[model samples]
Target: MKNTLSRLKYLYRKASRAGADYYNAPYRAAIARARREEDDLFMLLVFSEMMGIPNPAGWYCMELQPLMLERFHDWHTRMGMERSPLDNFRCC
Candidate 1:
């Protein structure tokens, strides 16, 4: 778990520097159905801190699938591998 956490830290650093966001658009449409509350904001701040970004001035369960997909795509592309849909292991 420690190794995974450390690896995640590296990925988070890379992602943050690349301007990735948990609150990106597809995420917003999924999770921001209502006004963000206090606890939600706290989680955002924590995530922001872990990713080494400025504490989000706020919080919002964010529908996380889209950004997750985007990241997979981004990584695949950057690797110069042929992009695949990652669904049932099909080609993209």
Candidate 2:
């Protein structure tokens, strides 16, 4: 009886997870797009100085450069630039 109850509980949990995933499938693409846009905005904020844009939070954003540099190439390309916008930094 204990084993049967445990098995039933496991099945119930599995079914719940599957159901949730199925329900969320339609919105998955929208969620992914929104997340990507948010990241792109964050990258822009971090690299705004390099792109010739004056960043109001430049002092605070300076600390984030090293961490965000790796994604700089992708971000600039996505923004329709053929090459790195920064004269000092070239990635591509």
Candidate 3:
């Protein structure tokens, strides 16, 4: 009887996790998409000069390029871009 009770407890925990995951799937996806969009906008701002859109803060943005380099590949992939928009800059 003790073994059976332990088994039941484990099953209950598993089921609760599964149910929570199912219910939260849409919210998780929306949040992920929103984060990706936010990252993309930040990338655009950092690389605006590459797009021929003269950025007023272009000089300040240059310093952040090295720090943002690692995320560039993943960001472009998430945006469905074939290559980095700043390919000409080659900082990534």
Candidate 4:
């Protein structure tokens, strides 16, 4: 009886997971696109000064440099940049 209960519980969990995935599948792509756009905007906000765009929050954004530098390469590539846009920071 215990063994059967365990098996039933496992199947119930699996089915619930499958149902959740199916329900979320349609919104996944849209969520991903929105997240990408959001990241792009964030990168722009953080690196606007280096990109020749004057940013009002430049001072505040500077604090994010250390945290964001690691993602610089991916961000620039996605933005169609062949190389880093900042003269001071080269992220190939």
Q: What's each prediction's clash count?
A: 1, 0, 0, 0
What tens digits encode model 4's per-residue C-alpha lDDT throughout 1-92?
A: 99999999999999999999999999999999999899989989998888789999999999998899888899989889889888998887
Ranking of models by TM-score: 2, 4, 3, 1
On lDDT, the leading prediction is 4
TM-score of each: 0.22, 0.78, 0.59, 0.74
Q: Kindly indicate the candidate among 1 and 2 with the higher TM-score.
A: 2
Q: Please list the C-alpha lDDT of all candidates, in the order they appear.
A: 0.50, 0.89, 0.84, 0.91
Q: Indicate the TM-score of model 1.
A: 0.22
Candidate 1, residues 1-92: lDDT per residue as tens digits? 99999999999898886675644756775555443344344433433533456644423313443444434444445446675524443335
Ranking by lDDT: 4, 2, 3, 1
Higher lDDT: candidate 1 or 2? 2
Q: In model 2, which runs have C-alpha deviations exceeding 4 angstroms?
A: none
lDDT comparing candidate 2 with the true structure: 0.89
Among residues 3 or more apart in sequence or in different chains, the pairs in candidate 4 whose N, CA or C atoms overlap within 3 Å are none
lDDT of 1: 0.50
Model 4: number of clashes?
0
Model 3, runs deviating above 4 Å? 1-26, 79-81
lDDT for each residue of candidate 2 in 1-92, tens digit (9 for 90 to 100): 99999999999999999999999999999998999899999988887887789999988898998898888888889889989888887888
